[model samples]
Target chain A: MATIETPKSQYGQIADLLISRIQDGTYPPGSSLPSEDKLADALKVSRVTINRAVGLLRLSGYVKVKRGSGTIVRTLPVILRDAKARYAARMQGTGAGEVEARQHNLVSNTVYRQIAEVPAPEHVAQTLDLKPGDPTLLRSRTLFANNEPTQIADSYIPAAIAKLSPELRNENAGPGGSYGRLSDIGHGPARFTEDVTVRMPTEQEQQILELEAAQPVFQIWHVAFDAKNKPVEVAKHVMPGHLWQLHYGWDE
Target chain B: MATIETPKSQYGQIADLLISRIQDGTYPPGSSLPSEDKLADALKVSRVTINRAVGLLRLSGYVKVKRGSGTIVRTLPVILRDAKARYAARMQGTGAGEVEARQHNLVSNTVYRQIAEVPAPEHVAQTLDLKPGDPTLLRSRTLFANNEPTQIADSYIPAAIAKLSPELRNENAGPGGSYGRLSDIGHGPARFTEDVTVRMPTEQEQQILELEAAQPVFQIWHVAFDAKNKPVEVAKHVMPGHLWQLHYGWDE
Candidate 1:
């Protein structure tokens, strides 16, 4: 390959060169790139310029640096935007005619419902106004986009309402998923609010999510309300932090 | 101190003893406990049992075990619960009181307006509905509880609304803190949501938060809504992960 003499001021251009190489598999995830000195010499740029370019990549989450260890390429997770506008924009560009954002790229879907006998967690019980360990339906599913796990969601519904929805027992549901199933049963959630937090992965989660030891997982705890302005269902979603982008719109 | 007798269930007793010592500050945070054999003999327990107990603690995040190295006591981070009913329950009887749960104990609070103009990142721009380079108000605070560092939150608001709130200028207007201030100004947030994730700490965050290299931080992104159903503020909070106990609630 011909060595390109990139300009010192063109840090972005140099960073793009590395990104392209990684995309082409020239430097696979977890692989180390050439030393800064070597790269600077090869690119015919001062090491300081090369350092600045690498700094940008680090901030952008492209590569990771270790004090004694060399810089290593990072694996970018499958990112899904949480903003509705962004979702609509992406969906519009898809060739499929009005496909559900989830089903359009469905990797795996599951629905499990019991007699709602599982004890409610302290947090869940208080929110639902039930005694701790109250019976509730625990429905969970893992979603994958392009063969990569994107999100895992666990939802709990009070037995009173879940029992009313026989359709929920059906094995195959449409793109509407749980939210739709609840609506079909006449307990549609009119609004939802979520509390989000992020933290480093536990050993098991790190292994299951195929994430780096340092990669954190995002947690979204959502509570949906019914028409009477009553809380109905609570759901928890966990995903690799880098994989999802959250967005919202507000009036000035 | 008188050594407790070696109970028939030696491992459990051993684990309990060590945990008590750690909690009471004998094995204070970041300090290493005695070796397996030393601890086992001191507590008259078998090495196997001692190892198992340590393993459990590591899993529960009470301690960090290094390969070929000793186990170190982990510092617990104070958890900021979601804005919900469950928070009230957990914090009760903790001696901090109910309103204490309403706000993180403020350690350092400062407000600055137009201190500097910086481009909004892609995600921030979308949430605030501003061009990428539009100016925004950046509010930063460090929270403390039990006289120890708890969490650090940085909020970015549209420059326009921020200018309207004198609290931002005076530094002490809202009773419930910034959230309270929003409501006092008729922008009382009716609905709020947050997304949380956890991962390894950045070297800088770890140092600033006085966290060890082995520990991680939790990052939470929150958005508050006003009566007009508009997003009035978007804030990012980062805390040491070990001490937090996240809570959420929903009504059935």
Candidate 2:
């Protein structure tokens, strides 16, 4: 086995080197890692240093350690979040009306579209304060990151609001998307709340995102309200779980 | 091929049946699943109904569906959450030299604990307004739901607050135990704010939680505060991604 060839306190460096090899398909997932003693001898470092480096890798979710078995390489995988502001802008600007503001970060494979349909899920109906099987417009997309499949987002708008725009039905055409369409129709979200949950990838999710067996994904539910604080839309994103690190900072 | 023999609308029920079989070692992880046609035939249902049932399983991360091949059983996993209330009450009550309040979920197998230790991570230090590498007592726990590992938590507290009780270290002697000692110490959390993210499980996490290859876990970071809104402690929990659904309802 190729050993970690570096000095102690060089844990990050060693980790990066190993991770790069794995990312580049050198040390393929499930490959056995070199023993710490062997790695230290080859790297000209003490076992303690190798241990720390491996420990960091383990903590970061890169490698697995088994007592009877040896260490094994693990793939770096996660979800892609379209909940970012850029995505919101992309959906709106691409649809209709004079695009006053341009949204950037449009990847080649990304698909954006608006579909008018009835709300199918129970949770969505409750959020929109509509009965089950209620009419709703579903604006959706399958997002990609670096040409890799990422997320499937479907946002539902009440039929009453959706009927205001006959242009919203076009697969790729709607004024400013739903957010913009809502504004164009004289309604804008004054308040929005987001609830996020992490769970194992559903089978369809695993296939659509092509995630490995161990990868999970994030399901983010975003509800937007108009000036009257009436819930207007609920956007649900089934995100791939391998590619995000969320950071939240609060002020006192 | 065992088709869903229950009510058609009961998606979760079928999923639970399959999950229990897998969990109890009836069909170990990575085992092939019966074909939709076969299952439907066995259960005297249409393939459409079987597909819907299977779809639910796939969505919840219970099974994998391959185009050329067939469906495969998935692993039902657990989450790891560190409860901080146990420690919060102990630390605060001890500081006031008063009896502490202890809280536990009504469900059996739910548990809590707290301890004192130096915080180490930069994020925790920044949140607590402490210098890097400062001494802080760390209290944490492994939460269980019905004797199954739900989450593993790690919490950090400033040493100044921890020194209020001298016998804190000895309390952690037993593995997977913490709440009782916290009562003796008398500290409690008055408030808590949580920041959560969902993603794929790292290799280290997979092993710790005994997770299967396809399962992901959620990461929740919570910061507790005292009655005066002073920062008390920061806790991190790793929860199994597939089994959790977080709910947040806000009224306008």
Candidate 3:
């Protein structure tokens, strides 16, 4: 485990040494690190120093400490967000989330759903070009990646458009999710603008997502425009930052 | 200021109301909100509740509190990452970071620079197809937006290629930055892959970026490939998440 020389700072040195080992695959992801006492003895450091080093690793998201199970190296799930593939999936009657999960060899499910006709929130109203409090169909769902809650997504569409398709009112928006149903009604998204921000999760969000105290949330606001450049659907996603990486590629 | 009816939870309700106001432009970005005492009195809540609500807002990136200044609405600088524009900027001998800053009407400056020849980290080595400890040129700089430290960019290029262009070794990286100089030497970035993740900032990062305690950092790992699909440069950017929003648009 000790491949590199220790640094000046004791605990930091230990942490760096451990991180190097982890990176070099001496300890693979989801694998447990040695016990604190064992690590302390191996590194010729105090138990307190080893504990502090482990704490640093946990804080930086290199590892996670389970209550009874010991420390395990963290493995983040990567979602390849290919713009063209995502749009093609929507056209083929599959939700982009489902497509992403499938690409990662994971099953995606909607763990929770709340479909209601409510007053549009100010931000959503602005994106949809509707006045605040205007009636809109709000579909809120918790998307799970392999049965683990991964994101909270809320989509808003004008009440008129939502009424045109019965599928839009159900949890399974037949085939491609909302976009597929919208297309059935002669309105398909032609373009998308995604705005991503990061912040600490709220108490409620932390509970719902089962996020760690130090985990921040990625707030993605996606606005889809129709062929005519009119906003058709506005969605917001709050995803636990530590569990996910958003990957995108482009040609120069 | 209280346009909506308060919910059952006092502080949460107040926070929600305040957030609505902030979203609707009642409290514009960079404008200070009323004092705690004033907010407490207006919401008919105790000062403790008002303080808690304000703290929530701060954590959620809606506001920031300075030592003497009251809570001020946060204004996230938008970086429109247009693929064509970014690639064009790089081809025309301008760094993409500079182009982004110019679009936002802000001057981009490199406030810190560390150039060295060192071993490539495991990830960078893999991306660059180099053996660990193989010579690589590391150019690390702290990029400032209008004098505010916003990002720490670290670029790793193979020492062989880096040595071909003196511009790659210097702090200023004379016009068009490393990629432009790389083009002069017949190796230009033709493709790019960007991976974005979010996490809490370390103590050292917090001080370097002057980030708030609750702020998270966006870590972006970018790998640029040349016409032959060979990875030419790998870079990592750590940006204070609360102060920046990454925007990208795509057609369906």
Q: For each candidate, give its TM-score against the true structure.
A: 0.56, 0.56, 0.77
Q: Which ten residues in a row have the lowest lDDT in candidate 3 chain B?
A: B1-10
- Candidate 2 on A23-44: residue-level lDDT in tens? 8987786787888898888878
Candidate lDDT (C-alpha), each: 0.60, 0.59, 0.80
Candidate 2 global lDDT = 0.59
* Candidate with the greatest lDDT versus the true structure: 3
The local lDDT score (0 to 100) that residue A92 gets in candidate 2 is 50
CAPRI grade of model 2: incorrect
Candidate 3 local lDDT, B1-252, one digit each (tens):
111222245777788899999989999978999999998898788999988888778766788777788778876565565645766787787877788889889888775457888899999998899998788999887877777787888889999889988777777687677888887888888888878888766656766777754467899898989999999999988988876777767778
lDDT of 1 by residue, A74-123 (tens): 75443434433332332234311123244344433232323234678889
Cα lDDT for residue A61, candidate 2: 52
Instruction: Tell how far residue B105 is off in model 1, in angstroms.
Output: 9.2
> Number of clashes in every candidate structure?
28, 51, 5
Categorize the docking of model 1: incorrect
